[model samples]
Target: MKGFFFFLCFISFSAFCLAQQAYPAAAPLPKKNISIFGRGLYPGDDATYELLKKSGFKTLLLSSFYIHADGDLYSGDSHLPIIHNGKWVGDSAYVVRVKNLKKHSSISRIEILLEGRWYGQPPNTFDFIRDWYDPSKTVPGIVTGIGEQSTLFNICKVLKEVLGADAFCIDDESVYDSPSIIAMGKIAAKLNMHMTLCPFTKYSYWGDILRASDEKVVDALYLQCYDGGARNDIKDWVTALKPQQPIYPIFMVRGSFGTCDSYKGSKSVDEIRAQLKGFKSDYPAMSGASIWQMDDVKKFVSMGCAVKNPASGTATDVAQFLKQLKTTFKREL
Candidate 1:
């Protein structure tokens, strides 16, 4: 009887061990693919497309507004002349040119920038400008305060119709109120658009509201990684938010008090890689990254970095670098 009892005990122990080995608490899901966006109005030229494809960019974030143009700051329209000297001309022709290049390029996604606030218009009545301009004014104009509800809906309608962009980026740098942020997200979802909220680092107070808004309507979060202090500090900021939402680090290559300008830091490519690397180490939730500009990269290389223009680099160089970068830090999805 003792010998039989020992034999049964041995079998039970072996089965338990085997079961534990077979399923060692499934490991956490791996991070998602790293996405990069090129800022500025994508010229869609052969060179731009080729360079971007070579650099391993899967998505291009094309800007509709000339941010630096001398005009009403709230004006979202591209000032590039549509007509000159009785000839229908300017960027429209370039648009066709770019579309052709994109057809044959390796790029798979395109996200057009849609400005949230109207330039020169008072914040409250900004939404009415579009309706006022519209021959059929479905939205009645009214003088109201900056954070009105009706204006928010009208802005959403304009963005859906005029921009027709894949993603809607909220460029309201000044306003960080929760109600406005949530309203924007709600409207974006209604229009079947993904929302990328841009919140400045100076007002860290808004972090909580931003976090709350993320829970509601925000699809992606873009923290301006410039003008603030240290680049590494961004890691901490991102951590504090504990955002499960997709976060895209916007690397500033040019402009005032930007990372590249003040730090005299890494080459544009290196800066992009470094920021993404830092985000990965600190926050596993980070989805991808986007550069403040393509043109700035070119300008920086030409003026500051002794390297050849990114556009002038060999196609092989662009492709190899991008392939290696993506391969080295590929996420599961």
Candidate 2:
């Protein structure tokens, strides 16, 4: 009986050690040159990848992946599961282009963004996490029900194996459940992918997740400095999570809903420069900055979204817009 008890104890200890080993301490934050959101990137053509290869960005965060009912995952506007029952069912072109882009581009890291709330739509991804995450069955560094049969785990696996993703960015706007996010961080760790927080508000909620999980897994914070997060101050976040993890502010350029200056977060190039200067002044160790997306860039050009501030530039093309944005980040911050 004593030997039996010792054997059980040994097994438990080994499991604990294996769990810790699964997610080692996160490495130091990389010095970000520029991280851009690719909302219109997946369906892009060879020209798009060519343009992106020369875009001078270090990270490309594919925006807004959703998990629909019954563990079906979707990206952008496709009505089918990109991953169903642990198999890739989406278009092969996307995977091929992404691989080629990474192989021949300045992009060193590619992250898939799991977002809540889409253009005033329901928060499907967060809802899925809420319903599917079995907190009562969790262990020290991992969660139960996030295994082979789990949709969450399957999606993470496909994103890592198929998409070659380096990390998962959590944009939990509505659901502030720390346990669910911590569970996701652990799952990401299990797949050897890091988890990043994209929080516009609810600093305490994010703080709770960071404190609960290993810092290496939940390594970076991308603060949205646009739209609803227009009033967000960078100093507060820097103060809260500096030296441990790096903080990068994300900005939305002037172009969305076919209006430039009308959008509250939409800023002219000069405005962005000034804002970046202000952020740098507040925190000198600020990691870097990111642009919201590429779809808006096209909308601004095609919809004749005239320059609100003529002094900014006379350029009205997509190339000009991207160039100006890349130049602003390179020169300002």
Candidate 3:
């Protein structure tokens, strides 16, 4: 009886040791948030939304409106449009459209893209005068100057009040003067909205611009990573600017400038993918990546942008790729 009791105790101790060894303590997993930007130029149609859902995207950066040539604001245009279920709704009807989308779709977060004149110029007053003066006459021209500051301020106020946007993206950096950028940041903070500054190149005074803006108000820094030029530029920029700030890397799948230049030698999806894969492998500190202008991707593929084994299917192909990334990385979308 004594021998049997001793044997049972030994067995129990061995089982406990094995259990502790098999189930070693592990570290907590990091949270990953995937966001995509939708250009009003292309508008998020049913197909786009379907792709987003399949790709496991939880947030959308939407282009909401733009300043028109007539010193007036227009909603639905090449730059800004109100799209619902793939249909174009008028600009004045953005609030209703966004509400409906939230109610019907799986979109939880909305970031509005606020665009103005290319170089911080006020809307063209001559165009307004011509349009109002004569119905059948083309507007000649107008000087765009500092009046843009007031116009931008007014536009920001109206957008926050009407659209109830959670965040805003400053699409044009030419207009991002220190004072104007800081003022916009203040307005965003008052309205409880986050701000994203899209810096296309390292030469742009983004660091100074961001510094002028309220640090608490700015949420993320969006770096346009398109060509090899951008790759080197962004890596250096991030290294210099990684001071408790989130950096969002934006990749352009198709565009006029960088896409043509970078992919000229190798004209295949595999080639493009290889370039991106190398970039990610080299620079693993990127917060997240978003592809530029979805329509451009479609256009490129249609225009024979693929290499040897052409990437087939619609934007769905890109979505699947993103989903696979999430699974492989063990990251949340």
Candidate 4:
């Protein structure tokens, strides 16, 4: 009995040591590898990140960095530009918020998602889209013209030096063309910033971008499978794209309030676990997992249509769900 017990102890210790190296830890990480926790926070809702640290979610995908027709930049909810005229023009409050987020938080990595799609806008107006543009146009833009390219390069440099973000994730749902995506990746590399791609449904389009950005240009791919994208199957994606980069599958929460999507939503933590299992079974090579948010805690369990309603969900519920996810990955991998 004693000999067997000692054998079990030795195995346990070895496993623990292995996990320690790969588990979530603070920033300035030693020889950074693919992060296990890749979380997205809505442009204004940062409250959930405080609770999220408990689950070891260290990567913050701060979003909606809005670019303008004139190569200007803004955070989604905050209309004021953070960059302008090839400079970090962020106001005092904006600067403080970013500095404070890094200084007093567990986040070691922060990446802003570029959001520049106007679902229904005139063709003449520069959409701040993913294409080299005609500089003569009245509107300024990103990835277009020599001036626009310079402006984007400056924007990336400022994000690195002033705000201390590591990468830029393109939310180019309405990208003008493929090369523009690659151009953004090249510019990010020139500034020593990692390029991340966030795509839904159009795997072929994103797959091409991923190939162009991998290793030398891009570092991560965040694929969404919810709402209009609910039809996206992880297995199909893996077979089709065969991405060489780490894929951090992102799931839409806010499922309870129909805040994002209701179709195929996980109504409870149990459902989340099951869905995660299914995802893993399909794409076993996934580097990690990302939640679309931390801000949504059980806001409405008893509201909305019964079929579409996640009647008993909360933010803590989401955190607990992540805790389980971390444990499962640790054990399996």
Judged by lDDT, which candidate is best? Answer: 2
Model 2, position 241, has a per-residue lDDT of 51
| CA error at residue 79 for candidate 2, angstroms | 4.1
RMSD, one per candidate, in order: 13.3, 6.4, 15.7, 11.4
Ranking by lDDT: 2, 4, 3, 1
Residue 322 displacement (Å), model 2: 2.1
For candidate 2, the 10 contiguous residues with the lowest summed lDDT are 135-144
Residue-level lDDT for 325 in candidate 1: 44
Candidate 3 wrongly placed segments (more than 4 Å): 1-31, 40-44, 68-71, 79-97, 100-106, 116-154, 173-176, 202-204, 227-231, 254-285, 300-333
Q: Model 4, stretches more than 4 Å misplaced? A: 1-49, 52-55, 91-94, 100-106, 121-126, 129-149, 214-216, 255-267, 298-311, 314-333
Better of 1 and 2 by lDDT: 2
- Per-model lDDT: 0.47, 0.77, 0.50, 0.58
For candidate 3, the TM-score is 0.61
Query: Cα deviation of 71 in candidate 1 (Å)?
Result: 14
Give the C-alpha miss distance for residue 272 in model 3, angstroms.
6.2
Who is ahead in lDDT, 1 or 3? Answer: 3
lDDT of 2 by residue, 148-238 (tens): 5566787888888888888889998887888888888878878877989999988788988888887778778899998889988899886
In model 2, pairs of residues that clash are 26-216
Count backbone clashes in candidate 1. Answer: 4
The digit string of per-residue lDDT tens for model 3 on 243-283 reads 34566556555423334323423223333455445545656
